[model samples]
Target: MRRVPESAEAARTLVRTALAAWGQRDLIEDAALVITALVSNAVHHARLESIRVIVTRPSEKCVRLGVVDRSRNIPYLRTDSDGDNTRGRGLLLVDALTDRWGTDRYRWGKQVWGELTCD
Candidate 1:
């Protein structure tokens, strides 16, 4: 996945593989959703040649997903003008689906991340 919109799918695949290996198959759906949103934001906004996707088991029951890109711009949940609007809802979905979400800033870029817990 090379900093393109298609990379989101690749990221999702990685998430699925990692989760299933960790016996967290139930998280595949929500994890995929978050990786897509985070990757899509990077591809559309970062304009870099490469990006990084991370799926980590911070704890036995928690998975943290992160997308790293070389852009100073941080992602925020955009306020929708109306309910009918079809765009800019990605972070909104991330917030609803994840137990917690935030970013890690580095000198080169930022990693926007979300966490999901087995319930």
Candidate 2:
């Protein structure tokens, strides 16, 4: 789904709808958090031009969620941060919550994606 939500709530709703189809109610919060953070990062750093959230069921037990932004910059996990730093923890949270995650560059931009397994 491609959306240009002016706020985080709209992004959360998109994630909720995707997860609901898989009957993975328990993963909603984590998924929403991941989506929100990615979208926020795109908005803040990538200029928030356009966002694409793709939800794919690669198999019966695995669902992949991808957030594609207009920027081609790939996200990295920043560990060396000041204790007082308020930003730069989104990907870390995604790493902790999802089964697997990574990024790939596309023709238009780059996609930061995570996979959740309903095992």
User: Which candidate leads in TM-score?
Assistant: 1
Output the worst ten-in-a-row residue range by lDDT, candidate 2. 1-10
Give the per-residue lDDT of model 2 (tens digit) for 20-81: 87788888888888777777667666644567767778998887777777787888988787
Model 1, C-alpha of 21: deviation from truth (Å) = 0.4
* lDDT for position 32 in model 1: 97
lDDT of 1 by residue, 35-95 (tens): 9988888888886799999999889779999998899888898875768877678899899
lDDT per model vs. reference: 0.89, 0.77
Clashing pairs in 2: none
What is the lDDT, from 0 to 100, of the residue 81 in candidate 1?
Answer: 71
**C-alpha RMSD in Å of predicted model 1 compared with the true structure:** 1.4
Name the candidate that leads on lDDT: 1
| Residue pairs in collision within model 1 | none
